[model samples]
Target: MRNRILILLATIAIYSCQDKQKTEQDNIIKTIAEDTLSKTVAGTADVSDASPTEDKAVELIRKQLNVLLKKDLPAMTKEDRFFYYEAFDLNNDKKNEYFVGFSNSYFCGSGGCSGYILNNDGTLINSFTVTDFPILVTTSSTEKFYDLIFETGGKFHLIKMKNGKYPSNPSVQEIWKGETPKDNAKVLDIDGKKLEKYSF
Candidate 1:
């Protein structure tokens, strides 16, 4: 009888362990699936093709920007080149506006970068050179802000200005500065504004 009781207890223990292991595995898989789904959704929502009126303008602007980068910053490798062209409702306006960003590499890499805002009619509104690696680019009423939260060699920086201010002087003081780690940087928001160092 004692032998049978011992055998039953062992079986129960084994089953309990197996159940716990399965639960853990399920949790891990669930987390991974959630993350992947989030990324896919975010990417899809952010991508926008140029409209009929802006299609030609986007191509022209892209061509011009590519030429400028190739001529001026020849050190950028082909793989490092990236262009983010999208249309969104900037400034809470009913009409969608163009948002463009040219980068040499990821936010932490070396390269020259520029951001542009275009009117809904495809006219140039404003453009500026962002001296830092911009991880995220966004716009608002009266100003467009580029968030350089994860850029390397410096902290976060925010570039902001009104439309038609292309080639405007960059105010370093207005940029958000923060102390970021060399490998892993933590992004912090202060008083609704990103705090980080700004370079011209």
Candidate 2:
């Protein structure tokens, strides 16, 4: 009788130990699974939070601008520099002309940011200082080129091609006394979506 009782107690102890060991293993696995799930959720959020992917044309333009402004942009970091651009056919030649705005301390001033109008082949048509973005193209044409307009210092300024080139300075340009064009489209608003990061 005594031997049987001892055997029964030993069996119970063994079973209890096995059960505890299995529970611990299960808990470890559950903990690992939970941690992995949390990390995956965080990773997904990171991807969604980033800016929208840019198109191929914009990417190619960035590379071109990098080459065009190589000397002035080599020292600037990716965060401190930006460029805003818009394309339109100013010459009525069916080829689009690009308007590239420089958003950095080196190029900007109290008047406004500096910008450029480039031909379809990335050649500089004109460079401007102290001007606003989204350079409005008027419905009226001058010398077969679209008249450009922008606002600065609470006044609108008109830019017409003179001697085959637009005005290089906006701060001193004559302010437009006429009404703003109703058919113009605002090209580059200064929001996060339109500003492209400057890269070397």
Model 2: clashing residue pairs?
none
Model 2 poorest 10 in a row by lDDT? 44-53
Give the TM-scores of the predictions, in the order they appear: 0.38, 0.64
Tens-digit per-residue lDDT, 39-111, candidate 1:
7788633234536655565565566556545554466554555555555555456776665554434322243
Clashes of each: 7, 0
Q: Candidate 2, residues 97-129: lDDT per residue as tens digits? A: 777777667777788878778787777788887
Alpha-carbon runs more than 4 Å astray in model 1: 1-82, 104-111, 133-153, 162-171, 177-200
Which pairs of residues have clashing backbones in candidate 1? 125-164, 176-196, 177-195, 177-196, 177-197, 178-196, 178-197
Q: Top lDDT: which candidate number?
A: 2
Per-model lDDT: 0.50, 0.73
